[model samples]
Target: MIRLKSPSEIATMREAGRVVARTLAAVAEAARAGVSLSELDELAADLISAAGADPSFLGYRPTWASTRYPGVLCLSVNDAIVHGIPDGRVLRDGDLLSIDCGAYVEGFHADAAITVGVGDLDDRARHLSETTRLALEEGIAAVAVGGRLSDISHAVETVARGAGYGVPPNMGGHGIGTKMHEDPHLANTGRPGRGVRLREGMVLAIEPMLIESGRDRARTARDGWTVLTGDGSRAAHWEHSVAVTGDGPVILTLP
Candidate 1:
């Protein structure tokens, strides 16, 4: 069931979102060539704990996963898409890194992700990251009271498709509240006037995962967590937890 958050509840989520925002910022700053992905996970874990917020992704086992997620951050590199486990692999120059993190504070949860270039990134990698960010912004702008949920999806699709990129129809965003995932799955492509009606107090995580090949298929890694592009092309992901209010859509994860 879709549940609308109360004002007090939204405030609590904002606190959680800030923790996530700060953690993402710290992780991004620490991300560079020669740094192991595991080190980034450790840094995120410590930051989340120090802020009095719990790491939402740690030990999280979704219905499709064979085991619990073992890292605080989902660090996807290069062709690796979302859910990449932090390991001993060292980042290289020009590597495209996508870091996803979640935080729980006062029983509410917030989730977000960002894709960045490690060092001197190539032109294609930089363009993919920029397009994903703009797709996320376009999705957010489609969220409004009384609008259909698919409007957001359609907006995202317009941006990605126009750029000759591909967005997996299955993997997108979701409603976020007490739990990291909730109702109303937000696809990256859909009919604008279709799907659930948006209402005040509804919070959604509108993330767009884009593949450079214009093909949406991906493969699951042996770890049962990391997902990579089927054509071995690079991918980018960007997200924000937003709340629909009478005034407008408020991005809770902004620092």
Candidate 2:
């Protein structure tokens, strides 16, 4: 069943979202060419713990995965799209690293992701990351009390495709609250007027994952976790957990 959050519950989620936002910001700032992905993950873990929140991605076992997730953050570098495990791999000067993470606090959960360039990047890398981030902003703006759910999807799709980027069909956002993933799976591409009608108390994680230069599809690695671009082009992902309110669409995951 699709769950609606109360104002008080949303308030708690807002706190969780703050923890997530702060942690992600810290990780992004700490990312450097010489740092390993595991080091960044560790930094996020400590930040989440110090804030009295738990890492939502740690040991999370989705039904589609072969085993429990082992990282605090999904650090996807270059062609790796999402769910990229953190290890000893050192970042390079021109790599694009996608950091996806979540935080849980007081029984509520918030999820968000960001793709950043490790150092000096080419035009394509900067364009892909910036375009993907813009798509997420447009998707968040689409949330309205009486609008259809796919309105957000359409907004995201339009921004991505118009920029000549490709979206991974299987990897998208979802409803988020007590659980990291919930009912009403949200695709990046859909008809605007279709799907569930948006309600005042509904909260969703709106994310856009765009592949480099319009390839249209990506591939999953053998780990049954990491997603990859098909044409060997770089990819970028951006996300935010948002709530539909009487006032407007309020982003919970902001710092």
Candidate 3:
């Protein structure tokens, strides 16, 4: 069922979103060559705890996964697309790292992700990241009173595919409130004016994941969590949790 959040619940989620934003900022600032992904995970856990929130990704076991996620952050590097587990692997210069994080506070939840270059990046890397970010912006813009969910998906697809990028078909965004994942799965590509109708109080995590080679599929990692490009292409991901209001869309996960 689609859970519509009340104003008070949205406020609580905003607080959780603040913690998530701060955590991502801190992780990005610390993301450099030689730093292990595990270190970033630890940092996220500490920051979330300091903010009086819990890491929503920790111990989360989706039915599709083989086991519970063991890290506070999903660290996808280079060709890895999403659900990348944090480990002892050290980052390197020119690597693209995608970080997905979630925070739970007072029974509400906020989830977001960002992809960044570790150091000097080539034109393709920068282009992929920037395009994915812009795609996310487009998706978020589609959220408003009386809008359709597929409109957001179509908007995201237009931006990424227009840039000659590819989007993983099965991997996209979701509704979020009191849970890390919720109803109304937002696809990366879809027909506009189809699917659920947008209404006041509906909160969603709209993310755009883009690939360099225009490949539309991904291969799961041996760890059962990380998902990488099927064609070995570099990918980028960006997301934000937003709420549809009577007037317009209110972004709750802004830093």
* Better structure of 2 and 3 per lDDT: 3
Q: Per-candidate RMSD vs. true structure?
A: 0.7, 0.8, 0.7
Residue-wise lDDT of candidate 3 within 1-255, one digit each (tens)?
A: 999999999999999999999999999999999999999999999999999999999999988887999999999999999989899999999999999999999989999999999989888899899999999988988887898999999999999879988898788899999778899898989999999999899999999999899979789888888889999999999989999999788888888
TM-score of each: 0.99, 0.98, 0.99
Off by over 4 Å in 1: none
Best by lDDT: 1
**Per-candidate clash tally:** 0, 0, 0
Can you write out model 1's per-residue Cα lDDT over 1-255, one digit (the tens) per residue? 999999999999999999999999999999999999999999999999999999999999988988999999999998998999999999999999999999999889999999999989999999999999999999999888999999999999999999999886589999999888999899999889999999999999999999999998898988888999999999999999999998989999999
Clash-forming residue pairs, model 3 = none
In what order do the candidates fall by lDDT, top score first?
1, 3, 2
Candidate 3 lDDT score relative to the true structure: 0.92
How accurate locally, in lDDT, is each candidate? 0.94, 0.91, 0.92
Give me candidate 3's TM-score against the actual structure: 0.99
